[model samples]
Target: MSIIMQYIFNGIFDIYSIQSNYYFFLTNLQLTIIVTCTLWALCMGYG
Candidate 1:
């Protein structure tokens, strides 16, 4: 039970860290560009 709790805690911590880093590195403009590029790629790939 304790191990399971630790695993869950670690997962939450990892997600928080990842999200923090993502926001820290990418500004609004960069995020918009990235999302646009990703969507364009997906559209091109699938359609």
Candidate 2:
């Protein structure tokens, strides 16, 4: 039960924090695309 709660908490954390290191050069539109793509992938992966 604790493990499951931790997993849920981690998933919530992932949704809040994007993988930020690689896309520093991206413009706002490009960053929005990357973030939306990541978020969509995360939703699909979690669901």
Candidate 3:
């Protein structure tokens, strides 16, 4: 019973870490895209 609980807890922790990393990666990607688009627009002087 203890071993099963340990495995379950470990799995949950792993999943949490994976999700955190994915969120961080996605936010970074979004920020990069936004910055790139803003720069492109500024260069084109569409404003």
Across 1-47, the per-residue lDDT of candidate 2 in tens digits comes to: 99999999999888656655334545666989999999999999999
User: On a 0 to 100 scale, what is the lDDT of residue 38 in model 1?
Assistant: 100
Q: Estimate each model's TM-score.
A: 0.55, 0.44, 0.83
Residue pairs in collision within model 2: none
Choose 1 or 3, whichever is better by lDDT: 3
Question: lDDT tens digits, residues 1-47, model 3?
Answer: 99999999999999999999999999999999999999999989965
Off by over 4 Å in 3: none
Better of 1 and 3 by TM-score: 3
Winning model by TM-score: 3
For all candidates, what are the clash counts? 0, 0, 0
Give lDDT tens digits, candidate 1, residues 1-47.
Answer: 99999999999999999999888777876988999999999999999
RMSD of 1: 9.9
Question: Which rank order by lDDT, best down to worst?
Answer: 3, 1, 2
Q: Candidate 1, TM-score vs. the true structure?
A: 0.55
Q: Note the Cα lDDT for every prediction shown.
A: 0.94, 0.81, 0.98
Stretches of candidate 1 above 4 Å error?
A: 28-47
